[model samples]
Target: MLHSIRAIVNGSTNFILTKMFDENLGFKEALLLAQQLGFAESNPTLDVEGFDALNKWTIFLCHAYGIVTTPDQILFTGIQNIHKSDALVAKARGQQIRLVAQAKKLVDGGVAAFVLPQFVLADNPLSFVKNEYNGVVIESGFADQQFFYGKGAGSFPTASAVLSDLSALRYGYKYEYKKLYHHEPNQLNDDIYLRVYVSFTDVKNIPTEDFEWIEQWHAQEDRKYLSGVIALKKLKTTIWWKENGTSLILEPDPIIENIEVRKLKKKAWNWLDYCRINLI
Candidate 1:
């Protein structure tokens, strides 16, 4: 069975975010340019707020794994809450922030999905894709992994996709989606562990108890962030996570088992076979 599909299905917001990182443009400034260039609509609520990615994710689900789901049927997070500080933290660690829509086949044959912004490490292939380009990484038992990339938005980009469908008529093409009908039902759960970064304003209000083992936390008069591993479902139920002026990024788990960071500033750890500060 297919394991997972992680996609960046929205282009407009991606373009806007890419500009913010590459050019140091503010959110509104990048958004205006995205609109002027036709990458984004005048009202980009769907794109910026992740509804567009949710819709696209459902479509991909129907075709890839043959599961029917709607935007409201799943949990989703948008990119509007992202800050320049968030991107700076990622960049300082040689990473970039990207909006990701992910659908996974659970171990119990159940399905789960969500859309959120992620801090992608420089070594990840997804990190290379920027601007209006869209990428999908398909993980499966048989094939192991496969990645596909293309333009996911724009009039010409959309037109070309339609043209491909029209051209397929000569070869008789159709989506098989053989696994659509199944016993599994789509659901959300906290069984999955995630390494997350949470930013807060009030120094005294941060929920230190919510995290199982906090690896590192930064607090200042203006800037603050917490890094640790926690269950997604549990984090969602917290008021601190649901409140405004808060942001979260799920980081990849380290390769080393029971890894401990003693002095991150003095010594280097081979978490991804490179020099990286181990937050846990």
Candidate 2:
């Protein structure tokens, strides 16, 4: 890995090759190589979950705070569990879901590491990132705040970042170093969007009162489906319920579990069907 890092730093060198013998050729290979080559001194977990953003955050912590922390000490989350329903819900609320990984220095000489889904507000810098784009923000007393935005992952991007590190190392840039201290977890609160679908036949048996509730929460029309419009509300209520093979759609008043979200979708479908029949 050091050789690879060195090659990247050289800049003049092109076509660096890395070979992995492991059966799972995913991020484990990269993580292992990084550790073996001293780029990282300990095992990292998020590397396997495709959350390399956390790894990058650690590197930033090292540079900014002069601290070295184990991967386990960082709180990591992944987007593997995000469902289509969630995305749809976000769209209904005039928002989008982003996989955000962040680290920050606390007041007590510690750092915070975490990764999860975030609903970027229109004015937030991260809201501009689309597709696979990535962004980073750093704040400190001297620098006030700094922002780094670019491709967070991909072979070429990784290579570029490695190359930059190599150039700095080769130039004999002296960096101030500080030991890592255990820090409290970051208190994260971000909205999420979910998209749900229900069979047309299963949306006719829910109660009228439930349908009224859904109508009140309705936000906008959805272009993807003909039967339903996009709806928005807080993520805290049980807006959907299922009954007698019918499903209903409704918006939650506050944040709820994904399972509850599923159940709500089922109920919403049922409610829609009931309205269709009564109108007919």
Candidate 3:
């Protein structure tokens, strides 16, 4: 019955992004404010680099789908590369940028998981989760979609969560970990495809050949942006995006199934064959 779980699990990054969106602040300025307010650590590598969200998502999978895995096993991208330009562009398109952690169960008993900065459309509930708030959406076959939202940071929320746990103990409550105990035939799968928006300072470094199909491209004197479909495995194997001034964010409804990718490839091949016969 479990289908997918998507959430913004890191409050610090969310706060930084919200400031960027609402006040037109740069990423660094917003991060500094979060640190000053005790919302982020002095050394915020874990949060800004997405390791924190990856940790939370790793645990979420274990509880939700009985799939146990480490952070290193999943492909994750942070908000470090984001800039004011990216935020402004998203706003122009009626979308917001959020650090999204997501996992979906495939029909083949596999689970696809990733943590990345993604474009959330205006109507998506996650677009409304701003500052230090967290929101989770769980989709299932029968229950449809359920959303859980709450304050996700600061001293009070931490204390509140602890107090709630203490109260549960008083009632002799315990975590059933039903999924883990029952066990499901699920393993991590990355042989998927995604539509992504990439912004880069250098065209050569962007690797245009890697994309399966490019839908949009914009080149400017200062920067370049492109949107295209690409194999998820290519992202997992490449580190080019992490170098220098480049940012990659998943396009809205980014996930593409394997069967769809194959179909597209087949169509491309058929078109190529027709062109070859006509030329001859």
Write one digit per residue (lDDT tens) for candidate 1, span 151-251: 87788997898999998887898766655655343454335546678777774666776665566778763868988766556655665664666887767
In candidate 2, position 36 carries an lDDT of 59
Task: Please give each candidate's TM-score.
Answer: 0.78, 0.42, 0.91
Q: Which ten residues in a row have the lowest lDDT in candidate 1?
A: 254-263
If both were scored by lDDT, which would come out higher, candidate 2 or candidate 3?
A: 3
Better of 1 and 3 by TM-score: 3
Candidate 2, 162-206: lDDT as tens digits:
999899999987655432343322232222222322222322333
If both were scored by TM-score, which would come out higher, candidate 2 or candidate 3? 3
Compared with the true structure, all predictions reach lDDT values of 0.73, 0.39, 0.90
TM-score of 2: 0.42
TM-score attained by model 3: 0.91
User: What C-alpha lDDT does candidate 1 achieve relative to the native structure?
Assistant: 0.73
Identify the runs in model 2 with alpha carbons over 4 angstroms from their true place: 1-50, 104-110, 139-146, 154-156, 165-175, 178-280
Ranking 1 against 3 by lDDT, winner:
3
Q: Which 10-residue window in model 2 sums to the lowest lDDT?
A: 1-10
lDDT of 3: 0.90
